[model samples]
Structure formats: C-alpha cells, structure tokens
Target: MSLEVEEARIVIRAGPRRIFGIPTYLNMLGSVKMAPARYLAGVARAEGRPLYAEDPRLRRALEAICSECAAAEAGEGRAVSRAEVVEAYYNALAPQLLSLAPSIDSIVVPCYTGALGEAVARRAEESAPGVALIAVKLGEGGCSWADAVYTAQAVDERLKSLNLGPASLAAISAALKAAEELNLYSTLVVLTDGR
Candidate 1:
C-alpha cells in the first residue's frame, strides 16, 4: 500500500491564547506515525511470518486472530523496543513537521509511553534548536492510560467542531491547559491523530 500522510494546520484561539495544530489522521492510512509499524506487521502477517515486538501495547494491538498468524512476542528471538519504534516514527515525522512549521516556538504533544516525548525532544534539539516540547504525561501521575484515553474521548465529544481524533484532542487539550498555566506563544500542537 502506498503511504501518504496529509495534514491540515489550524489555529485554535481561546481568549488571548492561540495554538497552531496539525492533524495527521487525515492521511490515507487513518493512523499517523503508527502507520508504518502497523503496515509492516500486516505485511509480515500476510506472509505467515512470526511477529515480534518488544512494545507490549503494539504486541497486543497487532496480535493476529487467525491460526495462520503468529502472536507478537518480546522474546530472545527479537528485540524491538518502544524507543526504537518511537525513533522510527520521529524520523518520518520530523521532516514533515520541520517543513510545515520551521519556526514554531513550542510544540505540545501527548506523551503515551514517554518514548515519543524523548524522540521529539531529541530531534528538536538536533535539528530545530530552541523549540520547546511540552509533553502531557498521559499514563503517569496516578492516572491510568485508560483514564487518559477516556478523557481524550470526552474532549473529542465536546470539541466535535474541531473534527479531530482522540489523540489530537489530547494534544490540543494539553496545549490549551498549558496555555492557561504558562505563557505560551507561537505554539504548535502536534495533532498526532486525526479523524
């Protein structure tokens, strides 16, 4: 399958606060940076190959239902850490982000496993220095990942006019909330997922 990622940059303004957003779910794959990993897993499954993923989330998500497919594992046979997955995602994501907004002051993103946050911060330092990354920890601080997911879903339901996915809502919510607490300007909210 041909992978094509498309994004729409929008300005979200509340009172004197404003944040730019790029929605990535509009891509042909329906998922943002997760597309490549999922695609590769699909290809392996189609070829009747055993899948291996060190990331528990990915392993569970990509587990095949049929007997022809093998389950993903974090075994001695292979080691694909979550960091590696995030790095690959960031490698593909950075160019698009840099090309779209090379001079943004800050980026607000949702931190799921912390790997994505680290990848974004590292890449921003290497390429786009001076760019601040604000990661809202989703599965930490006594809050379960499920709680964050449900909260994002609620935010999506309320902000239906924005036409964004739950992940996008999470980022946007974090950016807006951060705006209220901190002085943020020329901020870009990485809408990691879109509808």
Candidate 2:
C-alpha cells in the first residue's frame, strides 16, 4: 500500500528513546538495561562515524522526514545555548539518540531549550510528509514527564525488569499519562539532559 501523505505531520518531537534510532534499538543499544553512562561513554568513543554523524541510512531517514517539511516550519520556543552542549554531549556520549528515526507521524521535543530540539524538529518537519512537531520539558529532581517510567517501557521492555514503578505506583501512573499527553505513541523520540 502506498504511504499516507496526510496522516503524518511535522513535529518538534521529544520522547524517550535510545540516542540512536531503530538500528540501535534493534541492537539493544537503546536498552535502558545498560549501566548508567555505559551507552553515554560508548557514543563518546565514536563521535565522527556515519551512524552518528551522517551515514547513508541516516541521510535517507532525514531525507524521508524532510520530505514532509510543509506543515510547521520550526519550533517556536525559547532557545538554550546549552542545547549544543547537550547535543554534543549526548552525541558524544550516546550518538545513537541522534540516529535518524523511522518516518514518524509527528515530533514532540522540548520547547524550553529550543536548542538542538528546534534544529532537529525543523529537520523532522522537513523529513516527514506534513508531520506535526511536539515539544516537552523535564525539570531537575523530577519535573520532567519525558523521563517517566511509561516512557522507559516503550524502548525497554526491561523497565518491568526493575522494581521501580511498584513503590511509586501513583507516580508511574502519572508518568504514563504524561507520556500520552506528550504524544509519545509508538517509538517516541526524545532528547534529555542528565547533567
């Protein structure tokens, strides 16, 4: 069947997925199961590679997202100078997050920094066909709904592997709601700062 040209919309999407896109997911790199900083350090090690920088596959994916660049032109939020730092940091630590994703219906990134998110969102707008962009934010200690457990489960079936949500059932439930509100449907793509 031919792809629907309308259902999709450009989105400044920000969900919780591996640094890399599907290929990383397939390789289990996106897996939350890894030790903290494990993936981060790994990405740092391979900074200037095709997969991290601009591989053919990534170009193809970005091209696909760019194909739908008519809807939202760009993210209309405050910009953060640290975004490049975050992007550079994340890319260096977990370049996988930068991995081009599958053609998405829309994108939901944080409008606060508007740093890398805006650039990427614009790219997403151009990447998909009439895609919708979304933005979100997460505060320190725990104001961010993006880092919620519900978001975790999407990428890591192993979320259930840990006994975290049980104690905070209410919190976990709320996280799920937050995830939904953020338009974190299937394969949500997000960029966050752990620093």
Candidate 3:
C-alpha cells in the first residue's frame, strides 16, 4: 500500500445567539447593569489605572466645564443654554468615557437628567461609537407613568437621530420594553416638570 498526503481545510460558521427569540451578540461585559460611575471604576481597576474622576487635573477641568455650563445656561435662554451645556458637558466627559472603552461593553444613561442623558449618549458616541448606548425611562416615585413613557419616547427619538444601525436601535427598544414590563422607576421623573 502506498501512503499519500492530501491537503485539508476546516471551516467554522458562527452567528449571534438568540435570546427570548431575539438574536443577540455575545457581550463580554455581560448586560449593561452597572451605572456609569461604577462601570468607569471597574474599568479603571481592571486596567490598573486611576479613574478619571480621581485625577486632580481632570476633576478641575470638569469643575471648570460645569461652571461654564452654568454660566451659559444662566446667560442664555433655556433652549440655547441647553445646547451649550450639552455640547460642553459632552466634550468634557468624552475623554474620560473614552478611556473606559476597552472595558465597557455598553453605556446606559437610564433617563435620569435629560441634558445629562443626551450628554452621556453623545460622550458614548464619541468615546466608543461601536458600543451600545441605551437610555431607559422607568416609572419614578411621584411621577406619572405617562411622563416616563414620554421621556422614553423622546430619548428614543434622539437616539434614532444619531443614525445608529438597526441592531443598536433594537437593543435600545428591547431594553425599554423590559423596563416597562418590570415597572422600573423613572429616572427622568425629577425633570418631568421642566426641572
């Protein structure tokens, strides 16, 4: 008998897994359960780096930015001030948020402060554009469910305007649905009456 060597090839096909009938990708960081601050701290610890919030230089810069935001809001009209604050705030936070990109799988604002929510979303976009950013609206104590729903809808609209792909949008929608089903507290309740 004669022995002959033949070339061989191996192929593997992989796709996102389905959860509750929805196809979702594997999130190394797991679900977006941690708050922004907690997530940042975790990332910093994992990387053996100090959180940006702990850096004196960044802290001072953030303070200056906050001051500037307050001045702009006070000097300008509400609408104009909002834009300025959002831009300034987002710009100030982008660096810190970006630093956590390696460890963070997603950013969830939880619909707390309207401006802050927008700023956080913008920061996430600037920091890790590919990462998921979800703004959730849940019922808050003393706040009507309708108000929360409205805020959620507004956030959804804003996120849509960001031009995120279908997957991102779907993720956000699914999160909102989960919140609604669980009757979570509304993070935007405080701002419902125009803050």
Of the candidates shown, which would achieve the greatest lDDT relative to the real structure?
Answer: 1
lDDT of 2 by residue, 1-195 (tens): 011112221122234411111112122233221322232223333442212212222223322333221112223211212443344434432333324346334333433333434455434444443444433432122223222222222323333332323212222233344445655443333433211
Q: Which is the better candidate, 2 or 3, if ranked by lDDT?
A: 3
Score each candidate by Cα lDDT.
0.58, 0.31, 0.35
Error of 2 at 7 (Å): 30
- Runs with alpha carbons beyond 4 Å of true place in candidate 1: 1-7, 35-51, 54-77, 140-158
TM per candidate comes to 0.66, 0.31, 0.32
Better of 1 and 3 by TM-score: 1
Could you tell me the lDDT of residue 44 within candidate 2?
36
lDDT of 2: 0.31
RMSD after Cα superposition, model 1: 7.6
Alpha-carbon runs more than 4 Å astray in model 3: 1-80, 138-195
Best-to-worst ranking by TM-score = 1, 3, 2
- How many Å off is the CA of 156 in candidate 3? 27
Q: Model 1: which residue pairs collide?
A: none
